[model samples]
Target: MTLLEVSDLRAGYGDLQILNGIDLSVNDGEYVTIIGPNGAGKSTLMDSIFGLTDHKGGTVSYDGEDITGLDTEECIRRGMNYVPQDDSIFPTLSVMENLKMGAYTESELSDEKLQDIYSRFPILEERTAQVAETMSGGQRQMLAIGRALISEPDLLILDEPSSGLAPHLVDELFDKIDEINADGTAILIVEQNAEEILNRADRGYLLTEGKMQREEGAEAMLADEEIRQEFLAG
Candidate 1:
């Protein structure tokens, strides 16, 4: 089932346009990645989906409901969550505090949800009282992801979750993402690490100049000589 669908999505910042009639979808429990060169509107696509950009045209549907132009809170209320590439966490808050803040929309923090997040990220549990600024980059990323998951979103949008992480930490972070998807949360990730992300994703979209160049199964895109030569850096 399609959990999120974006059609002819045109959005930008102020008068500057970025995405141009982009069409994309994420099926329930699927892992989808968007990859492209810098300034290709990859991140803009995420912003548009989360209603953070100026909506010029098109429709965004989630679970068969129209969500176009809805603010971030409305999107989150409708079982969607977004983690941007940077500045997603509160550096002054403790790990536990951040997780609790993620559940602010709820009447109260459910112990079950908190424990589930801790189970997925043990380091977070260990550092519950530690200030977020003191954590490692990978750990902070995990915390960001954990915070998103605290709401039990049906679809999770992640922008560059692996950015600035060590190679080994990137692998670990991807594994955690896989685990989260395995538990049935659909993921839409914008990533710069094309090779690693494509290897792990169920499908991938290659974007260039604010347009989708190709959308294909992960393995097929990885095997395409033209794609490797042009985008994957063969």
Candidate 2:
């Protein structure tokens, strides 16, 4: 049951090639992470999938259909959502209001769904009306994630959810991620926190120099000394 399948994806801005024939796949309800060094095209991969970049060549299959270059709105309509690493939320809007924006296309706004999100992130319900600008880094991350969840996407592409947060906050964030996965939405994550993300993931791909070098189970790969020294310490 493959929800998302990317084969030989080549994309870039203008003439600058970022993702070089990248191939990846995510099964239903799988927690997959792509760990890579900066400038290794992690962000570019997400951008290409969400149709935010110029994709020169590739096949992006979502739920058995090709969505190689669908616009953002179209992709969202296809049950695919993206939460980038930065500037994903409206700074001036209240948290609850931001969520309302996420549900703009939905005809029915259910408390049951909102309560489900709030249960996973208690902090969000506590600060539901607070302006997004005033939230802490960790809280902001939580809000960004919550906003995306409002769509109840079948697949959520998160680019570095653990960026710029304290150590403890990362753990809490991953716990929430696990909760989301438990509810049956597949997750595709790109995180710079090698040890942290890999430990929590079900599978991981090591992308470097714009190429995937290795693929393995999250915990098993985390225990590999060479991988730790290369990506974690580098």
lDDT of 2 by residue, 18-85 (tens): 88888999999999999878899999999999888888898899999999999988888899899999
* Cα-based lDDT for every prediction: 0.92, 0.88
Give the clash count for each candidate. Answer: 0, 0
Our model 2 lands, by Cα RMSD against the true structure, at 1.5
Strongest candidate by lDDT: 1
For model 2, the superposed segments whose C-alpha errors exceed 4 Å read none
Look at candidate 1 and tell me the lDDT of residue 149.
89
Candidate 2 backbone collisions, by pair: none
lDDT of 1 by residue, 127-210 (tens): 999999999999999999999988899899999988888888988999999999998999999987898899999999999999
